[model samples]
Target: MSDYIVEFNNVTKEYVRQVALQNISLKLPRGKLIGLVGPNGSGKSTILKLIAGLVRPSRGSVRVNGRQANRMLASEISYLSELDVLYPFYTVAETIDFNAGLFRNFDMAKAREMMSFMQLDPGKKVKDLSKGNRGRLKIILSLARQVPLILMDEPLSGLDPLVRDSIIQSLISYLDLEQQTVIMTTHEVTEVEPILDTVVAIQNGQLRGMAEVEEIRMTHGQSLVEWMKHNLA
Candidate 1:
């Protein structure tokens, strides 16, 4: 049996009268490229935050590597948020070195290589770089971490077609599926469809569907984007 890296059991998260997640139960096994897809208000980011231990469930339990998600497991998981969170004054190399110092599992060499592959200058300050470069930097930093699980929230947002293609290629080339699992949330389903192993769709804080990408395509007889529009609309 595959070892489960993340398990959500009857999880419920609420913000006062609003329920962000409802009885969410999911078992994410190690080493799979899982895609989370849904509409704007579908709580996709919430799930990523929950797994990253940024938020706690109101009820039930969330486990990461068989331990409670709240505990410190910085070396085991790396989360790339939807928003850029780098220090504006820091240079790209400085940011990488800071993360390397903070996390024992961070690979400085891998980080440097990724920066070079992305054509991102190490000396460029975060504030001075273009949006695309910032996005690339975030991806590079997240990917350089030698962790078991990586969660990315909207990693491809706000990029041109060419840069998007480059980012996708870089992601695929850097990932080692045998040793790591990647969970990414994106509304750009068509661009990601080719590489996703599994798809998990959520609507209005509830799981709409979960299946292998091939199975979804076979059953619907359409691409993931077409299926998503047909189902989500």
Candidate 2:
């Protein structure tokens, strides 16, 4: 078995006239909570999409579990997009049931447990749920999956501090780090600093640096935010 769960080797991605990602290479270890932080349009989302195999790379390769990334690799990953794609007409319970039917790895028991933990109303339609509740539901859907990798794009975006705190707490409470690896992109640096095992900094479509969260504090006498500022500058 490979030590890394995901690897991007000299990869580049372009869209029409814009370069989304430059020559980039990365190796993400298994069973880690990795934070990807960068300015807006810094190729963070593109990196996640490439890992999910939602788009083909323009150069080099992306690999998951030592195999080249492709659409078929979707089975090994659960992606939480920044955009909300839930069915507004479906009640909370129905949405869970639908996903349970769709994904072979969907853990129905885990979904139910998370639902109760998030205090979501089973009978409430998705449209009626507040944005915070909706966000919670989205998280439950992603985390309940039994896939080895989970990619979250701006999962904390637009959420109030309280909601973000709950979500972060839920992440710590539910994740079996021995069995799953998570890569999350967020602008909430300080909020997520406590739970992150590693932090990767990206800028202008290029990887700036990657470091262990504890290493930053212990060795450099700096927080992730300080490290990110120095690297991204």
TM-score of each: 0.95, 0.99
Best candidate (score: TM-score):
2
| Lowest lDDT 10-residue stretch of candidate 2 | 68-77
Candidate 2, residues 1-233, lDDT tens digits: the string is 99899999999999999998999998999999999999999999999999999999999999999998888988889999999999999999999999999999999999999999888999999999999999999999999999999999999999999999999999998898999999999999999999999999999999999999999999999988899989998
What lDDT does model 2 reach?
0.95
Q: Give the top-scoring candidate (lDDT).
A: 2
Off by over 4 Å in 2: none
**Per-residue alpha-carbon lDDT of model 1 for 1-233, expressed as tens digits?**
34888899999899877898899999887888999999887889989888888899999998988888973776688899988799999999998998899888898888888888999988989999998889999998899999989999999998888888889998899999999999999977899899998888888998777778898788867788876766676
